[model samples]
Target chain A: AQTVTQSQPEMSVQEAETVTLSCTYDTSESDYYLFWYKQPPSRQMILVIRQEAYKQQNATENRFSVNFQKAAKSFSLKISDSQLGDAAMYFCAYRSAPSGTYKYIFGTGTRLKVLA
Target chain B: DAGVTQSPTHLIKTRGQQVTLRCSPKSGHDTVSWYQQALGQGPQFIFQYYEEEERQRGNFPDRFSGHQFPNYSSELNVNALLLGDSALYLCASSLNSYEQYFGPGTRLTVT
Candidate 1:
């Protein structure tokens, strides 16, 4: 079984500052996928970034990046120069690869608030 | 192209009643997966449908059933609903890749 955990129930960040959201997962499979999804108040889940276990390098979007410590089973999200628009409920997810059926197990979530 | 779409934006049902939620996958998508999102929590995978057949399922029991049509549209059926079953039901469409596109979701309330 694969389980993802996001320890911070809530987080706050000042606009233009940076923030980090921690996530860790337990999976026995060596090949799998990790993801960060942002769900705004509108309740729409948006993909933020994705990382593959096979890759040693981390994944980064425009303002979002992930510190994927595979050995430690930690995949954390980092938002640089945070913007108010970034405020949302963020979820961390795990999907096994070979991807044997494309089902994802998600973490509880961390609500992010951007303060101006 | 339009993204995934779910029907009955909201529904209210009593305990022991049954409910069905519909979904239309994004254009050109052939796979559909269903998820249940309780208040203040991440969405939980219920099942996935492909080629009009069930490809995979989660820990949910037979009480949570689903079907996929030839057109790639899907439906999630929950029988003998309980108050614990109240949640937002989401439908996601995807290609062979791991990335998936989600719908707005149908909010179900079991009183």
Candidate 2:
């Protein structure tokens, strides 16, 4: 069974600054996908970024990036120049590689607050 | 392109009652997946429908069942619901890959 873990329950970042959210997982399968999803008060789950297990390079999308360490099973999200809009609950999720199977194992979300 | 959409944004049900939630996948998507997000917790996968057939499921029990229509729209049905079933139910759509596009979830509260 694959399990995602986020150690931080709450995190705050100064506006215009940067913040990194920690995420780790346990999985026996070597091939899989990692993802970062953000949910605001509206409760809309938005896909932030993704990292394929086979890709060693990290995935970056605008201000959001990931530190994907496949060997260590660590996938952390970094928000550069955090804005007030970035304030939301960020969740780390894992997807299996098998076809016709899209089970996503998610971590306990880290609530991000953009502070002044 | 319009993204995934869910109906009955918020609903409250009593114990032992049954509830039905609906989802429409994004344009061009052929698969629909359902997940449960508890307060301050991650969304747990319930099941997925592809080709109008159940393709995959998670650790959830029989109480959580679903159906996919010919148009790829889907429904999540919960029977004899309990208070523990209160959560945000999300509908996600994808292709052969699992990099899903999500919908604004339906908030289900079992009283």
Candidate 3:
């Protein structure tokens, strides 16, 4: 079974600063996908970024990027120049390859607060 | 294009009662998956449907079931509901089973 874990329950970042959220997972599969999703007070889940397990280079999208260490099974999200709008619950998820079940395994989530 | 959509944004049901939540996949998507998000927790996968058939399911019990229509719409049904069943139900759609687009979700409350 695959399990995602987020050690931080709450995090705060000053506006215009940067913050990093930590996430780790346990999986036996070699090839899979990792994702970060943000949910604001509106309760809408928005994709932040994604990283392929096989890709050594991390994935970056705008102000959000990931530090993926496949060997250690760690996938962390970094928010550069965090804004107030970045305040939300951030989730780290894992998706298996086609040969596997392909269901998403998500971590408990870390609530992000951007201090203005 | 419009993203995935869910009906009855909020619903309330008593214990032992049944509840059904509906979802419409995003345009051009053919696969739909359902998830349950308990308060303060990440969404948990319930099941996935493709080609109008169930392709995968999570660790949830048989009390939770679902169906997918020809138009790519789906329904999540829960019977003998308990207070523990109260949560936000989300629907996601994907093409080729890769990245998925999620709906706003339907909040279910079992009192």
The DockQ values of the predictions, listed in order, are: 0.73, 0.84, 0.81
lDDT of each residue in B14-79, candidate 2, tens digit only: 999999999999999998999998887898889989999888888899999999999999999999
lDDT of 1: 0.93
Error of 2 at B82 (Å): 1.3
For residues A5-92, write the lDDT of model 1, one tens digit per residue. 9999999999999999999999889999899999998887889999999999999999999999999999999999999999999999
Clashing pairs in 1: none
In model 2, what lDDT does residue A35 have?
93
**Per-candidate TM-score against the hidden true structure:** 0.97, 0.97, 0.98
True contacts kept of each: 0.64, 0.97, 0.74
Query: Higher-TM-score candidate among 1 and 3?
Result: 3
Docking class of 2: high
Model 3, span B1-111: residue lDDT tens: 889999999999999999999999999999999999999999999999999999999999999999999999999999999999999999999987888889999999999
Q: How displaced is residue B36 in candidate 1, in Å?
A: 0.7
What local distance difference test score does each model get? 0.93, 0.92, 0.94
What class would a CAPRI assessor give candidate 3's docking?
Answer: high
